[model samples]
Target: MIRTKSFLSLLLLTALLSLQLTTRAEDGYRLWQRYDQLPSKNHLKQYRQSLGEVMVQGSSPTLTVVKEELQTALGGLLGQPVTITENSRKKEILVAGTPASSALIKGLNLEADLQKVGKEGYVLVSKKAGGKKYTVIAANTDLGVLYGSFHLLRLLQTQQDISNLQVSNSPKVQHRILNHWDNLDRTVERGYAGFSLWDWHKLPQYIDQRYLDYARANASIGINGTVLTNVNANSLVLTPDYLRKVKALADTFRPYGIRVYLTARFSSPIEIGKLKTADPLNPEVIAWWKNKVDEIYRYIPDFGGFLVKANSEGQPGPQNYNRSHADGANLLAQALAPKGGIVMWRAFVYDNNVPEDRAKQAYTEFKPLDGTFKQNVMVQVKNGAIDFQPREPFHPLFGAMPKTPLMMEFQITQEYLGQGTNLAYLAPMFKETLAADTYANGKGSTVAKVIDGSLHNYSLTGMAGVSNIGNDRNWTSHPFGQANWYAFGRLAWDHSLTSEEIAEEWIKMTFSHDPGFVAQVKNMMMGSRETVVNYMTPLGLHHIMGWDHHYGPGPWIKDKPRADWTSVYYHRATEKGIGFDRTKTGSNALAQYAPDIQAQWGNPATCPEEFLLWFHHLPWDYKTKSGRTLWNELCYRYSGGVDSVRAMQKTWNTQQGKVDKERFKQVQMLLTMQEQDAKMWRDACLLYFQTFSKRPIPQELEKPANTLEYYMSLDPKFVPGI
Candidate 1:
């Protein structure tokens, strides 16, 4: 009898081990949609009871996807297959559909609630009707029902109480899109995650599973559109062969309510159409574009319109023909207008010949042509006037353009924020820019309101994120990089959501529900962006990274092709001081802003220390608010950044047992690289800047192990994402 009992126990142990092996590994491919089995049996029981029967009343492609997603999520979360029935007399019945598609939902008299939530909005309610408990996800359109389904799953995933739920939600911006800087050759510009997600070579024939997954992920976060190609476009993408490939992607994404867009190469008419000139005013050029756009719509009926990057960094544009930006945008806008498409004209233009401040060029060029753009044209403005730097003042054109709709373009890829290896939660950086008071109208005028069309009173609005997605298994190379993508979608859906709230939701869904682990990681992520700015470009210093690749420190970078392209041009370091002077006595770029903003940032004493050096050339001996000399403060800030990274490492170390071993170790290794890189940045920058400061490194701070010559001499070869 004893021997028999021992054998039974061994068999039970073997069964448990086999079950563990069969469960999915935490590889991060599922992202925040991991509907892992509930840990608490009591909670599972409650959810199973509440979600007893699902009666979906729509059969459209989008609603079909919604039903499948619901089944998958419910089965995984509750550890039981949910019953889908045509007629459910069950007390707790989950019903989902649009008012037009469902008689039951239409009869429920939810017109007031549905009216409050727009066409793309959803209303989720739990009510008792005639002694029967019912949970309803109702919307005015099929797309809204899809969004509502995701929200319902999110409530369960985040362990929110849904018993008395009455949720009404809508995206603040009309167009929430991801701009993939993916090339035809499968390389991604400024992308740190692996190769491009779209396999253009094998596309239109072999549909990779990643395509569907990518669409699902975007749809879950209320992203409605995707720009398939890079803004620095290739004319070949518009060719017949590539249009077929784009069509395949569009077909796959259509069911998820995601419309695919392309980057319109301004020279496509000359390159592909064999036109004499690609001028916007040229009749042949105009006809060529119109025919090309018509061909694209033939393949992709719901195609989103063009994202044009012209006359910047040598790309062709109307400027080449001595025409205004409005002329170029209007050319494309006229073609897409008939098909209900819109043009996203980039405002990232700067000219070496013009000889204006690089920071002031976009505002100068765009502010003049504000009301000239066509109704369907949106001037896509980068978050900052310059490139996606660590920290920058909100783009001057955000509030300056009231007549033209301006869309916010944020970079989700970590171009300057340590690329693939560092952990930098960018929601804080994004929030900082959105919350900045533009003062275009009055005190409360903010960048968020401007982009959302509330302040400007525009009918069309959009928020575009330069995508960080790639072929990497985890989507983003750095594990925490996924949070950046998630945060951008959440902010695009609702600009009012706090960074901390988004971080918490992401942490819970992506990693763990353990309060201790969540708290520690949240603290680490919240402070990461500031830490990067402190080490890289503290005191408003910007654009000092490696010359071409922008990999690391290069404060001594000078003698480039253009004066504005060099770090010395922006920093202006000399025996007197270090920093660019953009004041009235200097570049006078502050004059672009409203008088209130100019007054706030004009004086060095009143200017936020964070932006002091950005606008003023300060002396090394200048007194700082920290009661330290400018030189000493610089030393402290750089060192403090390194110290903060070490703190992140320490915090992550405590989460070993709480987090999955695979992701925890991956983050650990990345954190180690981040620490080394931080030190490299600190040592190389301070050593180079010491030449201009002529001041000793504060005795309290660590000294550089390598000389300035050694730091400058180092040339890293084959840097990724160049």
Candidate 2:
């Protein structure tokens, strides 16, 4: 009897190991769609009870994808193959589709709920008919049903209670997109992961499996559009050969409800059309653009539109022909109008020769041009007027352009937030700018409301996130960087989501379902953004990173060809004080804002200290909110940032067995590198700035082990993402 029992045990052990090998989701390639078995058998029982015989009652490409995805997801989560059923009367039957496609759902009264959710939105409800209980995912369109399927899968993946689910959701903005700054040669600008995902050399004929998976991940998160080329426009992409490649990608993404857009070179008429002048108002340029747009629609019937970066950083534009920005935007808008497309005109324009405050330049140029742009043109404004700094006040353009639709442009690449290696959860940072009171109309005018079109009542709405994706196996270089991508998509769909809630969901889906592990990691992620800001650019300090690559601390950077190109120009640290004064007494950049903003932010006492130094050059003896001198406060913030990173390391170290061994060691090593980098930021900045203040490092805090000359002499070579 004992020998027979031993044989049975050995058979069971071997079978379990084989099953685990094929089903492991250790690599982040699966991302948050991981459908690994429920951690708790009790939870599994609950989910299985709520989700029984699957019946996606539709027949189309999108509905086909929905069926396959749900099959895979449900099979993985339940540790069993899910069977398709034809019966709607079966208790716990999961019926999903548009009411027109599913007779079971048509019999139910969901028109009011379905009407509330627009064409892209969905409704999930648990209903009863006689004695049979049914769970239905109903939507107005096929894409909405697909989105509903993903949302239901997410609820299961995150272990949410779905027994009594009654949810209706719609996207807050019309266009949620990813702007890939990828070039034709597979090079990505400001991309920290690896090379570009678009294999241009082998495209149009050889469709990579990664493309379908990319569309799957995006569509799962409610992202509807993608800009394929770099904002530094490439004319070759408009050529016939490249349009074929764009069409291949467009076809692959169409079923997933993703539309592809390209960047239009303002000088395309000269570069590809064989014309002498590429003026926006010129008849030759106008005809060339119209013909080109018509050709694009032929290749991709659902081609989204164009994103232009003209007259910014030496790019060609209407300014080259002595025309206005509106002229440049309207030219393309007219061409795309018939195709139901729009032009996303970037507001990142600046000139080194123009003697203007770098932070005030966008508002200065765009505020005057309100209502000049066509209805199909959207002014894409970055979150801040200057750049994607660690911390910046909301861009003044958000509230300034009420007549014309203003779209929010946020950078998710982490160029200034420690590039690739640092673990910076950016959802909090994104929420900060969105929730800021722009005061464009009155007190409660938020940047979120402006972009969502509720405050401004604009006809069009959208938000663009400069993508952090690349060919890296994990998409983003850091494992945690995936959270930023997920968070951006979630918030782009609904800005009302809390940072904490997003972090919790991401943590649960990405790392572990263990209660203790989830809570600890979620807390660590919640504080990561502030921790980065503290060590890198504490207390309103902006654009102090090293020149060119923007990697480490460089408070002493000066003597560049352009004033704004040097850290010294922004920080203005001197013998008596440190900071840039943008008030009436200084550059008067504060006058660009509404009077109420001018009154609150202009005064040092009333101004939020997060933006205190951004608008004022304060003295070393100035008292801070903590009753410490300005110098002491700087020391405190810098030290606190370093300490916070250490805490993050400790928290992650304790979660050793909670996740896969590969990602566990990966995060562990990354955290160690981050801690070292955080120390470097604290030491380098304090040492460099101490020369101006002539103040001793606070006694209770750690002091720099090296001199300022040591930091200045050290040069890092071959940095990624130039």
Best by lDDT: 1
Across 502-609, the per-residue lDDT of candidate 1 in tens digits comes to 999999888888899889899999999999998899999999999888988888899988987899888888888988888899989999989998998998889999
Model 1, residue 281: displacement in angstroms? 0.9
- TM-scores for all candidates: the values are 0.98, 0.97
Whole-model Cα lDDT per candidate? 0.92, 0.91
Question: Which 10 consecutive residues of model 1 have the lowest summed lDDT?
Answer: 18-27
Taking the tens digit of each residue's C-alpha lDDT, what string does model 2 give over 589-615? 888777888999999999999999999
lDDT of 1: 0.92
Residue pairs of candidate 2 with colliding backbone atoms? none
Q: Any runs in candidate 1 off by more than 4 Å, and if so which?
A: 1-25
Q: Give the Å error, residue 592, model 2.
A: 1.9
**lDDT: worst 10-residue window of model 2:** 18-27
